[model samples]
Target: MKKNIAKYIEQFEQTLNFSDLSWWIIDYKNDPGYFYCNKVMANTFNLDINAQKHSVVDTCPIAGDYIKNVHLASTNKANLIIKEYLELLNQEKKEYNNTFPYYDKNIDTVKYFSSKAKALELDEEGNVSILFGLIENITSKETLSKELKEYHNIIDTNVMTATTNTKGIILNCSSALCNITGYSKEELVGQKYNILKHPDTSEKVFEKMELALAKGEIWENEIKNQKKNGEEYWIKLIVSPIFNEQGKIKAFTTINQDITDKKIIEKLSKKDKLTNLYNRAKLDILLEKELQTFERYETNSSIIMLDIDYFKSINDNYGHLIGDKVLVQIASILRSNTRITDFVGRWGGEEFLIICPNSDIENTEKVASKLKDVLEFSDFGMKKNVTASFGISSYKENDTVDTLLQRADNALYNAKENGRNTVELIP
Candidate 1:
């Protein structure tokens, strides 16, 4: 049988160009020392080839300890690879194929290789006598695999991820996704991903989303979804279509994050709790932007300052509850009567500020007058129609926040002196 194996080796050498590839053989008579390679590997590793036919552990200096001592310190990956290869031998498998990294001592470089091995000859009792293998370098592919692993690691840490079939059936989901959705892997797999969808999100939005995915484009948007407990949440969602080797859609991968807290904070920061109008902070921001627009482009923008007439009397007589209701009613009227380009805010208690973009002093006064009429006609629960005094000021050249506000306040004092139910303009 040994002679037959030698003849097969001779025939293989003659049939194929073996010079370019690294080849090896093993007798399996010993442990790690049983492995042996040809003169090519010997020269590559600066080892003696003649002694490889014998017990390499006894002959070559690095044979038995090569995997441990030579592989890079980070993973000791070569040792693991060799251990798995030996386990395959114990399985009575006739062929072996695996890829792993190794250290080449002669060049002092770490190289990735695919090793393919097969039984070449059998001894008596059906034990293996000779094993042959071919090793090919694959460093570039291994490097890319390593980089992709790192990229996946980063994404896994930061995002909840899931994969669904083209039919929108869930295939797999990360632990983060399961955690956020209050579902287990057992419960999620094989379920339709629409289980998380919000009813308020129209079917048309989903149609557009699916259309984009069909075209192999990534879809990104804010999505409202329901959790397992029937609680709704907002997510910054991204969906990407995964294609098979044939360039056909195989699946879609989704990554998303909870943005419910962010949306709530933004809404709270910009709105007043009592009147549902914009808050003082938001009013300041809008005013600054309007002033900036006027400075840059000479756009006519104006501010209207209005104070609820005798607000303290309303609180003292009708109570703060009625005063709050009056404020809410006023905010609703302001929102209903003003152009969409105008913004209304509760600048402070009993003081409302309005920002009107592209409005001159005349248009601003007209807006103020219209507001006065609306307030005068609107009834308070006190059985009397409530009224507000208005002061209008258009943007002037070289105006700061303080100067603009001062002019409006001075105009408001004039309105109060002139008996409170009128629009006073500062030109």
Candidate 2:
């Protein structure tokens, strides 16, 4: 039986020689030294690779130092390390697991190692006497993780950063994000990330983001978000997936830049300075979008084109200043009478365009008639009443922006020929 046991031990040592892991056996009952150690294990402690026995604690001071130094990232992790050490010392558990940083004499640098050990023999008195263990060098992996954490820390302090779980729950956030959003870190953490979602953002935008993230792809876009004070802000947001060792997405990190000022500038460029309404260029874009919506979704929409009656006479008689005031007043009336969803813009000269999305000709005629009545009754401080003629055109299957505007212009001419201050619809 002793011969068979020695043969088995020899086979185990040979097997461990082929592995990168450091393997060793300790005889606690007889010598308090390693009964056998493979080359990797002996080389790790700078001991004799050919030696059959060595004092475990005398030669491996690194292990003793590791147990004495308990600096860990968190209290919970420190406690677990202590528990693992106690389990190994008492030999109460079937298996022991631990990781520690130790100064390597051979390399003259601190390195990290992971260890797994189990009891291999029992003494006559039923106590554990022989222990087998393996140690693996994990310095590269641990160093990379530490470097990544440092990078994240720097970004979180200087930029708007936030991290979320797969379920969209906010896990962590930066002070910059809290400052920009007007929320406290305590209030934002553990909350769903959508608390800042603005009502004006379409659901389709969020759907697209979700689909891309689910495929572990980065998503980037300009998003309009609301603050705690109900003020709207814009952000150019980029979201990246964080992967685990298994190459599966574990979380998402978002980096954002405030773009509200940029958005404001773009909006100003699209507006008419005189009346504070969308300029003709913006009107063209709105018209095209409405037409595309109709073609794609089969949703009906209409445009109302109205021209001030004899507007050249007003500019000549009232001076261009009073004419400008009249134009501003007319723009205000259009804004007040139309739904928020309607796009009201200055078409050109004395003409204004109102694009009513999801509205048919009948509903659009009602809107035009309401505006005509309002203009006729409202006092523009001019000597005489100022009235406007209205023309309406619904979007057709093959309608383009040019075709739609041409039809509306024709309808406006018909209204002017019939008698001013009336509304007419051209199908």
Candidate 3:
């Protein structure tokens, strides 16, 4: 039986092709054992091929005590599988870590087995043998598993993270961060995030950013930023400090959301759909702002309320198409004639209001007369010309926006009653 076991080990050694595996068989009752090793295993410990004998303990130096424990367990009729890691010298005298599994039974210990080994079996005649098994080095698989776990962790992080230093030089960024600033990863990696700052953003915004960052307090705000194409956008930015091991702020992590579309829809809600001009709702808001400015600065301002003359007749004569065309033309004229700072909005059907800031009754009348003359000569795709009646009212120190609008409206009614295509001032 012993000779047959020795032949089996020799055949296994010749068949096994891997260079990292070693095997040994131990007699259950004795400390010394007959060991068989492959050419690879012999080369691993720089052992001579012709060496007459070798000890399992000598070959696997670090796991010597673990092997003895398995041997003791095997002699006690225990079916045991033991696994351990050992540092051993290789062919080049270099130390390498290797894993070994041992199976023990009543008669013997089988050493340097594979992780697949379960237990050892003893024949009725008392010969011990390892169950069918094979060893495969899985170091590469273990290393790859560790690396893949790390990669997944990097992908799962939520920091809208641009890798920028304190000087605002960007390095790397996460996809969430890239999506917010309207920049692609390639475009933003090396550039400053401040490139998205809008001209309308005040110094106070920067002051707040610096103050909060200096105090290590994360800052959050709904801020306006510009896109790569010079289009303005808004985002809710939350900037937090990224600290180093020294507890010093190394970088700032900023998370942002694109809110420009929402803001635009909000602004559009305040505008007239047909004329694309500010609606009455927005006019109310603007009037209050203008009135407050006038009160503070003592600025002379006036309101001009105008309505198209015979507009219903035009719509009746030439379908609503031409009526719409006339309205759009008048809107364009108002927009063109008003100063950039002046407010022009559609008050209602065929009626429009103009707020001329820093303008008195004289300038308002001049603007109104100009509008009248322009409309009187303008063609609305009809055989004849179109005109409008203008009513002007100067803002009183004690007057409200509604009161000023009402006075202009009253004058407009007086103009339509007296004559069409003329300007009238509220008494």
Q: Which predicted model would earn the best lDDT?
A: 2
How many pairs of residues in model 2 come into backbone collision?
Answer: 0
Per-residue error for 362 in candidate 2, Å, reads: 18
| Candidate 2 lDDT score at position 322 | 91
Tell me which of candidates 1 and 2 scores higher on lDDT: 2
What is the per-residue lDDT of model 2 for residues 1-427, given as tens digits with 9 covering 90 to 100?
Answer: 2222356458776676787888767666666544567778677756777777776545652344444443533445546765874576586687778776766656667778887777777777777776677789898999999999998777777799899999889999998999899999999999988998999999899899999999999999999999999999999999999999999999999998999999999988899988889999898888888778898899989999999999999999989999999999999999999999999999898899999999999999999998999999999887899999999999998788888888998999999999989998887
Residues 1-427, candidate 3, lDDT per residue (tens digit)?
Answer: 3344456566666776544655443332232344445555455434556874456555532234345455433432222222221111111212223344343333354333333322133445643433223344454665576689787557535445555677777767777665555688898878877877898998799788989898889989988887777778788888888899999999987767667788889878898988989999999998998899888998899889999888999889888998998899889988988889889999999999998899989988998998889888876678978888989998788888878888998899899998888899983
lDDT of each residue in 92-137, candidate 1, tens digit only: 5667677765666567777677777777666676666666777776
TM-scores for all candidates?
0.57, 0.53, 0.57
10 residues in a row with least lDDT, candidate 2? 61-70
lDDT of 2: 0.84
Q: What is the lDDT of residue 158 in candidate 3?
A: 44
Order of the predicted models by TM-score, top scorer first: 1, 3, 2
Best by TM-score: 1
TM-score for candidate 1, residues paired by index = 0.57
> Of models 2 and 3, which has the larger TM-score?
3
